[model samples]
Structure formats: C-alpha cells, structure tokens
Target: MHRFTRILTRVVAPVGAVALAAAFTTASFSPAAADTAPAASGPAQNYLVLYKSGGSAAGASLAAIAQARGAVVQNYAQIGVAVVSSGASGFAARLQAADPSVDSAAATASFGVSLAGDAATDAADPVSPPTPAPGSDNLSGLQWDMNQIHAPEARSISGGSSSVVVGDIDTGLDFTHPDLAPNVDFSRSVSCLGGVPDQTPSAWMDDNGHGTHTAGTIAAAKNGIGIVGVAPNVKLAGIKAGDAAGFFFPEAVVCAFMWASTHGIQVTNNSYFADPWLFNCKNDPAQRAIWESERRAIRFAQQQGTTVVAALGNFADDLAHPTQDLQSPDNTTPVARDVTNACAVVPTEIPGVIGVTADGNKQFKSFYSNYGVGAANVMAPGGDSVLQRTAAAVNGRVLSTWPASRIGSCLRKVFDSGATYCYIQGTSMASPHVAGVAALVVSSGVTSPGAVAAQIMGTADPIACPDTAMYAFFPSVDNGAPQVCQGGTAYNSFSGNGQVNALRAIGG
Candidate 1:
C-alpha cells in the first residue's frame, strides 16, 4: 500500500540485510554537493538559496539570483531563504559566486515521489469493520484511540476553543467532508506546491488521503457525524506541502512553515519528514543546505509561537542513537551509509518541535514506531496490527476521515453517513493525536509553543518500558538488532513522556 508511513522496506538490504526507509512523503535536495549538469539550458530546477546571516533585504538576493540567470520562485525575506529556479548549467555554483550575500545555494532535484512507498501487502489483510450508524456519531465506540488518551473525558472539560487554530502540514485535507467542513478554516489554508502560498480552496484540497486522515484525528468537527476529534471545536487549516504524487520537497515545506507562522495558525501537525534522505545529515556537505533551510523555517515557526509537532518516522530505529541509514535518497536507488546522532529526522529532531512516538492500544510502543531517548517528546495511540491481534483492539489500526470522492486512494475504506473513513497505521497517525492535545492546551491559554510542549509532556501519563521478556517476541524487522529501550520510567526512549492524556492536558 502507498501508506503515509516511514518504515524499513525489505526491498533493499543495507550491508546485506534488511534496513530503513520512510513510508510517507519526503523530497530530495543537494545543496553542498550540487549536481553538475552539462552546459545545456533545460527546464528549470528549483533551488533554495539561503542568505548569509544578517544579510541585507531580499532585494539584494533576488538581484543576485537574476545575475546568475536564476528566476525567483519565492523570497522568504523573514528567514533569509529563497526558492530560485534556473535552467542554466551549474546554476548553484554561479548563484553562490554571483552573490556575496548568499550563504548557500542548494538545488532540489527532479523530486517527484510516492512518499514512504511501502511495498508491504496489507490491502486485503483483514475484513472491513462495520459502518457507524447515521447522524448519532455512533463511530465513537470504535474510537479506541480516543479512549486510550481520555479524549472523550477531556471534552467534558474543554472540546477546544474556536480561537485556537491547528494546521496539518501534510497533503491537503478534505474540505468538504461533513466531519471536517465545520472546522476547516479555509482562509488560513493554502497550497505551497509551487513554493509560494496559494489560499484558493481548490489549491489546497486533499487528493492523497494522508492529509485528510491526519486532519480528522486533530480537529474533525463534533457535529454528530462520524468520529469526533480530540480538539473538535478548534479551527483546522489544511496546509498542502506535498504534491499530488505525495512528494514533500524543501520549497513546499519551507512555504508551509512560513504560512503557518505568518498566518494565525497556532499549531502545525507535521506527519512527514524531509525527503530523499530518511535522516538529513548536514555533516554530509551535500545535504547541509536542505537541513539548514528546513531548520530555519521550523525555528522561525517556533519563534512565532506555532507549536510544531512531527512524526518520529515509522522505522523502528532509535533516533537518539542513530547508527546507519540504509534507505536514503528513497526517490531514487537506495544506499546504505554510516550515520551519527548529528544526522536527524527533520522537523521532529529539530529543537523546539515536539516529536511523537506511536503506541498500540496495549500502551506499548507500536511495533513500527521509531523511538529514541532524546528524540521523542511524547507518545500517543498509533495502532499496531501485529501485537494488537485481539478482539478488544479490533483491526489494530487508527481510523479517521478520508475523501469519499477519492475512494480509490484509501485501499480499505468504511462508508458512514455518506462519508469515507479508513483504518491506517504509522507514526504519521500518532503525531496528530499529540497536536490535538496541544491545541487543547493552547485553548486553555497556554499560547506559547514552549509552554504548550512543556504542558503536554508534563501532563502525559508516564509509562514504563515493557519488560524485556514481553518485547522479546518482537524484534526489529529491519535489522536483527534487539528492540532496546533506554532511559528511566518517567522518561524513556519507547514512550517519551508517555501516552498523551487529553483530560490532563487541559488540567482536568
């Protein structure tokens, strides 16, 4: 299935064994080591030209791009990053040399991806679950994830306030779905596929179901239709950072963050990582530009009080103690490279952003969720089909809204009240749960991103790592390395601060 998850694909064997690959959308960019195109003018490729610190206004950089034969796709003057397009050969080298103001000119390759292209065959794995009764929001009973986090109980205290806005920075969301239509803030929604903001409704509509599913988990309306969200009354904005093919290029991601910060969005749920490289290693001169550009954007958003929450990826590897990247430049051929903690999974690993790990109904780390002592900030229900093989857990996957019109996009779908919903799994599914809780905290007057993060971590239900014997049955699918958990009970690699408690998040 074309799942929105970053997991280890068995297709490529790193060091002659199974290894890592993200299952969701991401892009490929090479700034420090640019491609040397032969001297022939061709269709333009977009480049993220980062200006030197304390550089002059965007006008100077814009002029430098022109002198180097690069057309301006966008100029983020606030953060000193610009998206420039050029057909000229060696455009990066020319741009860097053309402008003393430019710190780095990194080129995004022909990045088109079916992100996290997990070739695993789960399309027909289980029988479709029963549909919910009409007009009564009967699906609430099937929402095991909500109950796990006490969202229903929390709603009695605060279902979220209209003043708080949460943006899902993924594929655009389904604006017309009844469960989502009531809360979707179209004015704040925008598409950044072209590296600039386009607020038109059509520009940000969900084609791939990943964004739509994630939005439902965050702020689907509690208007007596389908399942309710953790922060149902909060306004939801669809920030389209990925293209129709589900590729999340640096230009689009940068634009999404800029929009979220500049607009009134108080929180953003990022379920995908920076692409091509599963772990963006700035230590590698070739990938530094991509990492720096995204890092600046994330930092800018944090500065603007936007609580950025991201997935810890689907690969069951430790982020705090990263060792190798076996599935990199995934859009192209796979390569295995030795890595260190200096390499990071974007957005999530970036300081100030809240990184989330996934847990099953049993409250153990999901079989596929990535975890690390310092990398993950919190945990939430993301479902685990393998370990949760019991009647109480149903199919062991999280359910949320899907575009009814794009029925084909969701491999397994449940039609309820003329709406389409689907059951899916991934750290991508888990990140939004924390985002929703963060919105609840924001609604309760915790406006600062730093405070919001602290409240979520502080209020979460602390969970200890499972007994070694309990998890021994499950080993890392990518490598034979034993799935190890480090750190203490209150704060550990597997569960972070622990399963996010919605009721506690709002001081209930």
Candidate 2:
C-alpha cells in the first residue's frame, strides 16, 4: 500500500516512546536544515521573507531587495509573505542584516501528512458489515455520519445557501463528480501549493481522495445520486494546499488561509496539521517562523469573516499534556524529540479556530482522535469500527466521496451514477461535519464568524463523561492504554460541547 493510504488507515500514537535526540543547535544552519543546496552546488531553497507592514520608510521594498539578490517569483502582500529564491550563502540571515523591513526570514520547509503512516491495517479489527441500503435520496443510507449528526433534519430547516461558501483547504476537490459539481464554486477555488494562488479549477484536482472525501461531507449536493452532505446545497471552494503525495508545506498552508480571507469563503475545513513538525513549539527559534506565518494567516481569515475549523489530529493523546513525539519531519528523516507546553499543532491549537474531536457511531471519542481540555472545542462523528459498529453503518467508518482513480479497499462504485465513494476514519473526517454545520449557522443569518462559533458550541448537545469503570479503549491492536475523559457534561476533553447537533445549529 502507498504511504498516503497507510496514513488514512492507521490511528496515530499519542506519544510514542523514543529516546530524545540532541536539541537542535542554534548555530549557523546547515544546507539540509535550511532546505537548500550548498552554495557551491545547486540553487538556494525558497524562503518566505516576512515584512512588517506600516513601518517607517516602508523599509526597502521586498521586490527591489529580491531583484537585487536573485529572482522574486511570488509576492503575497495580503499576509506580508513573499517567496524568493537566491543562491547567496546564508541568504535569510544576510537579507535580515541588510534590510530592517524584514520581520523574519526562514527557508520554506516541506510538511508531511499528520496521520499515522503505518501499513493499511484497521486498528479496530473490523469485521465487514452489511452495505447500507439506499434510502430516500438513492444512496443516503450509505451516509450514517450525516444521519448521526441529524443532517437530514437540519436540511429541512436550511440545507445551506449557495451564497455561503465552505473552503476546503486540503488536497483539492473532485469538481467533476456529479454530486459535487452542483455545489462546487470553481471561480472561488484556487491551488495555493507554492505559496501563491492559481485560480484554474482543474489545477486543483484531488489526486488523493482525502480532499474529495472532505468536500463531499461538507456539501455533496442533494441531487439524489450519492450520499447527501451535512449542508447539501452550500457552495464549496477547493483551496488546494496539500499536494499529490499528501505533503502540506508551510507555503501552501499560509497561502490557503490568506486566500480564504479575501475570497468570500464563509468557512474552511483544515483536516491536516501544517507539515514538517507535528507539534510546532512556540519557543523554538527554528520553528517560530513557520508558526508565526500560519498564525497570522488564520487570524486574518477569522478577521475577514472566514470561520476556520480544524481537526484535533488522529493521535490518541492529550494535546494539553504531550511529552514526546516519535514521528516528526515525517516527509524526511523521522525523529523522536522531547517537548513541553510551549509546543502546539497548528490551525487546531491556534486561537479563534474551532478545534474538533472525533466521536464514533456510539458517540464515544474515536480511539484515535486527539483530545485536550483547552485544545478541542467541539465533537463530531469521525467514525470508529472497533467500538461503535452498527448493522446500518457497515464497517463503522465514515463514508464519503472518493476519486475513481484513487485506490482504497473500502471503495463503493455507485450504479450508473459515475461516481466513487469510500469508507474511512480519522479526525480529518470529523472536522468537515462541523464545517458543514457552521455553514448552516451562517446561512441561517449568523454573519459573524465568532458568533457562529459561539452558536455551534452553545447549541451542541451536552454529554457527560463516561463512567470510569466503563471507559475502555477499543482495538487491541493499539496501545490499549486506559482512557480517561475530563470535564463535565457541558464541556470536556472527550466531547467539547457534546456531539454537534446540525438541527440545533440552524436553531431548530
């Protein structure tokens, strides 16, 4: 199986045991650390030179500086981020020294998939259940996740307005899928893979099925073909940030949010963590640039009326109390490193963004979903076959759209519909459900992003912690550590406001 497929299949270990490597020295960066070739060899790596806006003298225009040094391929004045390539040795350090306008200069690093990359093994020890029967919408029965969140009832109140757009900043969307074509807003979609926006719709096609799956869950049309989405009529914008190989570098992440901020997207679902580092430490000098750039973009999006929703991640660990990380810089060399409170996963841990944890069909936290007291803000059905199986929801995994070319074991080919669907699990699947509900709230006249978030949290069903004796982590294949749920019914690490109720989200 491909590494990307494995990522979608396995549950992330919270804090895998490994001896911490030596702390990264703050001395002059090496060629590899800077992600560039040696000055004597190939060209310099691309760098995101951040400029402090509204400063005295407008301090040495980045374009002029870059032209003087090398070539300026992209300029993102919206977020004060510009990408340039220069072969000069120690380019970032040298540029900072020469110009007082640059706030920070760091080489752009590639990020890997945040999910576990083990072979395609179901952690739940799944047993094949009966296929879902086609319901009123032809294939609605295949969508247990939608029914679990009461999407049908919510649809009756407000399926969603075409004017309200949900930006999916992942791999991209299969805009050609019949179920998605009716709701996809091609003009609003863009590929932000190189820290720059490419408005061509086909340029954003999803090679991996992750983005297509997420888009379907958000708004896969109510056109009576495949499964209906949580907000079946809302327009969905594909903000392609992750590439064909499933890597979401910082340049792409920063571009996606900045693109969303100005694009009139009411909400965006961020299912993958920003790449390279699993937990970007705020205090680490090396990781600070990556965190700051992404932070500004997210805050800017929120300020611009884009309600940002992100997954808490698939690692079955407490985000608030992480001790170690065994899988990091996953696109390159893997390392185990000691960490502390100063570190955090981006987008999800960022303030103002709604962080979501995953719940199974049984309404329990999915064995793989990450949770933390302050980290997770809400809960939704992501899926779990081990602890939450039902005859109706075969395999217990969330079913959504998949690209025909994208291969997976649990694929379902629709009869005469010319569309492919699949069953998969992860916090990646859970965040979109919340994104759909957020769209409903916006469609129902909640204009403010903050107000929409407040409404979702306030209207969610309150669920109390399970009895200690009854708390058991399923899937004996995993660590099987004793699971604990913190906080009361109204709010807890396991289930934020409780499970998200789509009907209540629209004031039903």
Candidate 3:
C-alpha cells in the first residue's frame, strides 16, 4: 500500500566521521577506586562543562578551562558543552568560578553507567529450541520474537525501503557478518566513542557483541542464511557510542546524536540509559550539566529529522511515579538515595524519544523491564526467561546474530553456517523490534520524527495490565520491589500503546 517497493542490496561506501577516547579511562583513577576525583590532581580526567543556553559556543569556555589548568578536548558547540581534560584536582569549580558563561562542569564518568554490564547480554537464556522450518534459516525456529510481532507476515508485504537508514547507536558492529553485510550502510556508519567520529570500519567494528545483536534485529539481511530482521531491506548504520567495556559517556552520546542528525540518519535505535546516575536529578546542581547537555542533543536530533527509539530500562520500577533509587552513581560508591518524579532515566525518559518496554512471547511484561503509567510509549518482545518459557521459546529469550570471533559468555550460543549467534534478553532486545518497525514506517515516507512516531503508535496493538499476582514470582528481580500497573487497558505502562505490529506499520 506504500509508494516505494523493496530495495536491492548494495554496499554504502565508507565516509569519514575519536578519542577525546583517552579522557575517561577507568585505569586512570584516584586511589579511592571511585569514578569522581575532588581535584584534577591525578592523571587528567575528562569533564563536560555546560555553557548557559544562547550563550557563547564551547570555545568561549575553553579559555576559562585552560586558566584552571585544564585543556579543552572536544567542543560540542551545538549543545554548548566542552569536553575538558585536566590534571588539577579542583578544575571544575575553578573553571566555573573563572567564567561567568559557564553553568556547571562535572566529571564525565560521574554520570555515565554501563547498562546491564555484559553489553545487554544476560545469562539464564541457555536452552535452545528445536530447528526451524526446513526452508528457513536453521535457527529460525528460535525466533519467536519475529513471530510474536508478526514481522515475517509483514515482510511478505514490505521489508522496508533502503533509502531510510536506521542507525544502531551502541557498541561497534560486525560488518563482516553475512546477515548484516548486505544492508550495512558503510557510508553513514561511524564511531562517536571518546567524543569524535571515526568512519573506518575497523574503528567501528563490533568489539562487543551488543551492537551486532541489535543491528541484526533491526535490519539483518533476508539473504536465506541467518535470521531475517524486521526490516530486512532497509539500511543499517552502526554508530558506535559505547566502548567495548560498555561505558557510555555523556559526551560520546552527544557526539553520536550530532553525527546522526548531520548525516541524515532517519532513525537511531538507542538501547541505553545514558549517564552514571540511573536517575539523573535536575534540582541537583551536580547533575544539571549531564542532564541538560544530553537532553538538548536528543532534541536537536529530533528537530533535524532523526527519530530516536529507546528501551525504557531494566530497573523494574515505575518510571512515571518514581520514588526511591536503589542503584545510582553506578561507576563509584553507590549510595541508595530517595528519588522523586523529579529524577528520571536518561534518553528514554527524555522528551520526544519513543520509549519501549519489553515482554516475552506470553505477552507478559518482562520482570526486568522498567514500567510506569504513561512512561513507555510502546512495547515489544524483549523476552522473559522466568515466566514466559515455552516449547518454542525454550528459555524465553530472543535469538539473534552474534560475533564469530568473540568467545562471549552468553549461557547459550549457536554456530550456524560458520557464524555465531546467541540468545539474550532485556529492554535492549525489545527496543530494536520497534526501531525496525519505525524503519518500516520511515520507509513508507513518514520521514519526520513526529509523523514516524504517530504512525508507529497508530499501528501498535494495545494490551491491558496483567494480573498483579504475577509480579510476586519475580519480586527478587529488582531488590524485592513491588511492580504495580496504572492506566486503562487501552494505554497502560507495561505494554504502552501496545505490542508493535510490523504488518500494520507498513500498511500491509
């Protein structure tokens, strides 16, 4: 029913897109073993100095930083923040005191945490399902996630348009993987880690497997080999933002958005909760820079025609009505603090971004997924290992492409046709299902972020809250906190507008 037909496979030429990479080194730390340092006194530490809005660009703050014995590394002039490296112990306060144009300066690591430490790869998903149908990929039977969202049925009508490029802004991707090679947009792909763009494929290759898995779910080729993606014919650009260890610095995230917007990336699948504090509090002066800088970058990307789809989180808390934050300041000594609605998870909770929660094949919200009334905008099959297990979903996990070289610790891994694959779960896996749907929508000529979002929500299938008693079994998942559901059946927190329907997304 859409205008454009499916596109043929072609390699997008490499385009040149940094290590401002040495600034936030976990090895270069103060003896405290904490991510924060009182003085820039040890090895140089990286800090993001936020300039007041409508003021001078990051360059204007450079002089003040240098006067405080710090040197400006990368300047995100668009967002008015400067990445500064200094060996002086008290550089941030001194820089702010020396410059009236500066709002606040905070250590980059103080606000960036690795989501789910294993790069979104979780254990407890070891069981493998029986072989798929004879003609399909040998492992297709394990793809209950594709079947749940009706992606294959949708693909019969549309596999997305190649012109609409979707960027997976996570760990670097494995472009050599057969499933991803055909649709890989080599030209638009770049690594923004360390706060700069490096277009070299080796620079952005998948040192960590998270990016490859997400990329596979979004746009793996329908090449009759590995599993086919939700939007198999669309282009996939791997924009590496998270490091191999999985730390996502705020500056790196900002650089990624700037790159995506400037390069015309239509959709970016961000399965991360940027910043070290799980819940960044606005009133807190220490966190304002991290909160505002990242928010503005996302807003700018949206303004420039990039639709961002993010995972709600794995915290299992009600994001809409937040109370206490048990896990925060993740890189340093974690102090359990009382939180209110004033605090929120980065990127996902940020305005205008599409927030997705995860559910298994049984249609129950994953016990590890974060949810709240009106918090998430949509839901997808992220897989739940405990409650949703079935014959097909042996361990109730989503299966996708994995790197052949990396000897990852994923409980179960599949070697198919000489390539490696694995089973994993998280809102991380759930987000791409919707991102792929968003790509399908974008392929239909709904290019604007707002219109693309509207199309995705309009086509989703709504679901009501499940029995509250179900939460009892998974109480141990999130520190024994009680999971509650709010809103009507048509629009609840757990399932959001509803599970995404790929066929409906493309008007099949």
Scanning candidate 1 in windows of ten residues, the lowest lDDT window is 117-126
Highest TM-score among the candidates is held by which one?
A: 1
Per-residue lDDT of 1-508 in model 2, one digit per residue for the tens? 2234223334643233323344454466553433334334245556666777742112366544553364454556656766666666676665665566777666665321121111111111111221111224667877788888888877876787777888999999888888898988887888887666787777799887789989999988877787888887778999999888777878788878877877778799998887777778878654777887788889878988889999987767678777766557666555667777788888899999899998888887887777889988899988887667888666778888888777454454443277788888888889999999998888877868899999999988887876645445432112334556789989998888888999888777
lDDT of each: 0.77, 0.74, 0.75
Q: Sort the predicted structures by TM-score, highest score first.
A: 1, 2, 3
lDDT of 2: 0.74
Where is model 3 more than 4 Å wrong at Cα?
Answer: 1-40, 57-60, 110-136, 476-479
Least accurate 10 contiguous residues by lDDT in model 3? 1-10
Pairs of residues at least 3 apart in sequence or in different chains that clash in candidate 2: 111-275, 111-276
Candidate order, lDDT descending: 1, 3, 2
Q: Against the true structure, what is each candidate's TM-score?
A: 0.88, 0.86, 0.85
The C-alpha stretches of model 2 lying farther than 4 A from their native spots are: 1-10, 13-41, 53-70, 110-135, 408-416, 467-482
Model 3 Cα lDDT, one tens digit per residue, 41-113: 6766677788887654345555666667777666666768766777786666777777889898788762222
Residue-by-residue lDDT tens digits, candidate 1, 428-505: 889999999998888887888999999999999999988755556555433445678987879999999888999888
Clashes of 1: 9
Model 1 TM-score relative to the real fold: 0.88
